[model samples]
Target: MDAMQMALPIVGIVAAAAVTFYAVSFAEIREKSFEDLEDKDFESGGFKPSFSSRQRRARRKADKEGRK
Candidate 1:
């Protein structure tokens, strides 16, 4: 047989195996689009401070402690 004829079967076998693997993996991956939203507690009173505000608070505390 010629080089082309001999290589055709090998290429086809590899391609078939790759396609089978991809199909199996895709089927195994479950869909996740039906989850409940998180419940927020309004009474807890959470504060989200800015970066500058946090730095200023830390600096003030350090200054007050250093003066003692």
Candidate 2:
């Protein structure tokens, strides 16, 4: 009974520490995305590049040049 009682507080403390660590890590990651967005001008429709759009444009250009 004494051993179980001692173990209970130790377990609680460990669980609390784990929860605190995860919360801090999540907050840090969440802030990074917001920071990146803040650096861009959202009012100008935020010039974000898309990989697919670039690829499609290049393919169309190549096709057009090949036909000539």
Q: Which candidate is the best by lDDT?
A: 2
What C-alpha lDDT values do all the predictions have? 0.72, 0.92
TM-score to true structure, per model: 0.43, 0.57
In candidate 2, stretches whose alpha carbon ends up further than 4 angstroms from where it belongs are: 41-68
Clashing pairs for model 2 are: none
Clashes of each: 0, 0
Q: Candidate 1: which pairs clash? A: none
Per-residue lDDT of candidate 2, residues 13-54 (tens digit): 999999999999999999998898789996698966666988
Question: How many pairs of residues collide in model 1?
Answer: 0
